[model samples]
Target: MNYIQKGLLFRLPENNKDFSITTFLDGLKDSLSATLTHFHPLAARLVTLKQQKPPSLTVFLNPENSPGARFIHSVVNLTVADILTPTDVPSVVHESFFDLNKAVNYDGHELPLLSIKVTELIDGIFVGCSMNHMVADGTSFWHFFNSWSEMFKSRSFNISRPPILDRWILAGSDQIITLPFTHENQYINRPDHPMLRERIFHFSSESLSKLKTKANSECNTTKISTLQSLSALVWRCVTRARRIPADGNTSCSLSVSNRSRISPPISENYLGNMVQRLKATTTAGELLDHGVGWAALQLHELVVSHNDKAIKKLMDVWVKGSLLVNTSVHFDRNGVHIGSSPRFDMYGNEFGLGKALAVLSGYANKFDGKVMSYPGREGGGSIDLEVCLLPENMAAFEADEEFMSIVNV
Candidate 1:
């Protein structure tokens, strides 16, 4: 094998030979990035030294003592050619565990960079690889991707610097990070998704504007951004659409961007894991406190606050794992799980292939789904979103008027 003169290559081990597929995928995620598709090998940029050595287990608290640790995952070398796209050939179908197929989700011909295509090459047992945005943000991923191809095809190539995670989030000074979210403990029951799921939805700018208009009229609040209003409206609609008991309350999530909000302002952009939730409470009391507009306003305030102290407070507590954000949807006992935006834009990503036609994350019918909404190039006024929710909710949503107004669906 050729040496990656400048970049790094690491390896790790799986302590338990019986590591389940889920465990293997999750473990790979800690190391691999969702933006792996954007990166490639580079003799010069590559660090010839292995990244995982001794194949040992490594662990750390998530600042909140949130069972955070690193594990080693091993895989065999493999290659594929028939799998390449007509427009472009996939450099390596199995370059790493980050490329596993079973781990990825998408609705079209393109790939969800966040997923890895794990192939069971040998037996019912499988070796894994993955692709997650944070493993390599779009910018960094592309840099590495191009670099590798450049290295193999050319004599040498210069690679860009890797993305940093140090300042991704700065917890709120006033923020509290206590476990077993007592406040929302009851709403935290995990919904079972026995089957794997995938889904996609597209909206035009005009339709999105219509939805915004409806939200503005219904909530009597102009302070809301499209996302805030949309998220709020969606939460309510999803709950109603799915026939979920509204009396129990619900939580809609919105991931906040801390680009220039932090002290250091994580300036480098590649594949951003620089995302955290801005959860909205949908309980009647919460609605009364903020006038039912709580959800939409919560998002609007977070995005526009721009207060140094407020931003600092958020980041500080998050680092310490004491960031307390309770949403009505996650209002169950012990805190239900909810994830948001796998924020993709890094260094104005424009894959000579043209900005991705669409981007999304999360598994369908798997609890509340994760979403990613980014501006489309060529002046598509509508914001694009990707989601995964219960099938019943999805069907009901498709049949609702408010839902239609939210996205003009």
Candidate 2:
């Protein structure tokens, strides 16, 4: 688990005469403090108990000693168009987030588990949040965000979905297991990476419908979902754009939610990571030659087979080894890792300024072939894919006819 960073852009209030940065910050701080009362783990710290027999790791929350989440307020000399109108995301957008791109989840021991930076633009506001992945997955992260916004808007602490704080451990699995590493520094290593290009490809409802229909018709099945079809399309396009050898292997790893996959099913509001990464591998030739339908079906089967039994089995193996997730080691440059989700309510996080103009990601976990999906701002079934690739590959991918034919532009 690494840091999950996202930025939400909002236009300044129309009645700007009354808008004061001091008032806004006071409201935001107040709401966030109230929100953290329910989601207390965000204010907590990770403690490595090396003296214990197993040398366990724990999330310790001490109300007296806990340093609260970090809040930063910054003023930038930019406008809404500076971010929303660009096909390529501006490099300055990354500055909206806290400079914790190099920090992994274990850094929570000394650092804040959650940090929010409010950037006041010339005509808009960008609220960026960096949350330790060990504290929550996308669902839980959004849950907290939505709650905070709800409280801010309503001026009350009541939220529709209160988080379930009880941690879920497998029935037979050990509650405490030793981590493979003794120190957090072992996880921090800087590696030279290619100059990557990040772009958000918008696919309207009509285009997504066409893609889903084409994929289902080709496969002669309705089991493939819109997300699976979209993912398959990007995988194929990226593989071709990269000019990987036909015999070369490529894989698509999807971050799957395990809330429903568990036996009794965990609540949607569970406040922890209930997600797992599942990968489907195939040669470039096989994936491209068979078309998007074949690729989608492969993903469909992969997701269908990850049932409760499979989840438990994987957890058993993980508990035995206790291997912490390292992004550099786990991610493959040639393969695509689809993260975030279109299901998250990105556009609905309206504080007092109304709906967000757009959503952006931070620099953490960014590498070639990293794809973050968000529900389109217009709602409906449309999707916005924030894709990161090597500069040359991105150029080729944008020029690929088959891939561009379906883009909404």
The numbered model that scores best in lDDT is 2
The TM-score leader among the candidates is: 2
Flag clash pairs in model 2.
none
After superposition, the stretches of candidate 1 with alpha carbons farther than 4 Å from their true spots are 1-129, 132-193, 213-222, 268-272, 284-295, 305-307, 314-366, 374-379, 405-409
Write model 1 residue lDDT over 41-77, tens digit each, in one string.
Answer: 1100111111234322211112222121122344444
Residues 309-398, candidate 2: write the lDDT tens digits. 999999999888776676678887679999999999888888888989899988777889999999998999899999999999999999
What is residue 305's positional error in candidate 2, in angstroms?
Answer: 0.6
- Going through the candidates in the order shown, the clash numbers are 79, 0
TM-score attained by model 1: 0.51
Model 2, runs deviating above 4 Å: 52-64, 186-193
Model 2: lDDT to the true structure: 0.87
